[model samples]
Target: MSDGANLRGRFITFEGGEGVGKSTQIRLLESRLRAAGLDVVVTREPGGSQRAETIREYILGGGARALGPMAEALLFSAARIDHIDSLIRPALQAGKWVLCDRFADSTRAYQGANGKLGDDVMQALEQVTLAGVRPDLTLVLDMPPAIGLQRAASRRAAGAPADRFESEGLGFHARLRKAFHQIANAEPRRCVIVNADRTAPEVGADIFRIVDERLGDAAPAPAITR
Candidate 1:
């Protein structure tokens, strides 16, 4: 059902570990796209549609910690199904640029890399859940785990606590960074690594340049068939 008609609009995803400014860069790109008079729909995985948001809440509520990696991946896939059907598919079919904060890559990194997940399981989930919809381009905001964690902790609201993933130790985050690097290396065309340690404006400028250059480039090599 998610294999809607082929789309003309671009699908861009911003991916990174906690507090790597994925949200900030997304805003910058969205603003540029709107200024150029394009229709853009911004959404986030595991929490885009109403049902998906419920899954996000449960997953971040601390109870799901006890659940194994496979169970967690299933929950994320369930949310992704609702999100693609209810929000992502329609936006793409209508020819609106889709900007998502995190997509399947996050699942692969957080649950797959950091947890007990294998590539076979991750790939199969993608084939089923995505149903041939993959990002035209993915911006991987790369940064050290220690720096990112510090930034994330500082950004948290006063009196608020870190989420389950955020509360993870430094070692977990180091591997998470490597996991993202692996994804970028595997899909060179679809993935671009951006240094997230720089100032927000500097990072924003780098992203804007890449968007301008890459968006006008050729389409992503066919990864999933329609």
Candidate 2:
């Protein structure tokens, strides 16, 4: 591996409120990149590793009941630290292209918007927890909160019951959507907005085009299809 190979590693994050289909787009993008022969790693925050997954269960299962806002923020950061150390950093050091479903932005959105924790707290948390880990590019799946909530409701009805956050009302979800848009507006250089109201395949193609242009024509490496 030469300098180019070492520099090939990229951290790309997909961001959105619940039901914006970040997971679906991540899968589609990973598949496309793999077909093109690039070493791609797909992972998510709050549950990228066993330990983090445990924390994720706690958070989503409403186990964070006793935790105050600051404590809750710390818990999320703790999971993120473990996720970065155990998964994200290793994959990137191996020269793999990483696709993350959600990342620090979600914290700023949920904690800041809903918790009303303030941006300074979120920024400081990012500094200490992530140690300056920032995505090379962030694709924001933009959609109205009402539509997103409907999608989530339909999916939940078809699948398992709604999680704690999923049980939040439309107003809460609307705040989350606003937070995501605010984040993109605040950091245009690193974020690109994709209208997710379109069909899945169309949205997937938009994501692939952005990634393809950035990663160039290199073929992606093999991945264990899920």
- My TM-score estimates for the predictions, one after another, are 0.93, 0.89
Residue pairs in candidate 2 whose N, alpha carbon or C atoms collide under 3 angstroms: 36-219, 36-220, 37-219, 37-220, 37-221, 38-219, 38-220, 38-221
In lDDT terms, which candidate is top?
A: 1
Note the Cα lDDT for every prediction shown: 0.87, 0.82
**Residue 75, model 1: Cα distance from true site in angstroms:** 0.4
For model 1, residues 82-120, the per-residue Cα lDDT tens digits are 998899888888778899999999999999988969999
lDDT per residue as tens, model 2, 1-226: 1122334478899999888999899888887777766778898878899999999999888888467567777888999989988888777777788999899998888877788998888888988887756788899998998888789888775667788777888898888888888999999888988999999999987887776565454434443222
Which clashing pairs does model 1 show?
none
Alpha-carbon shift of residue 217 in model 2 (angstroms): 7.6
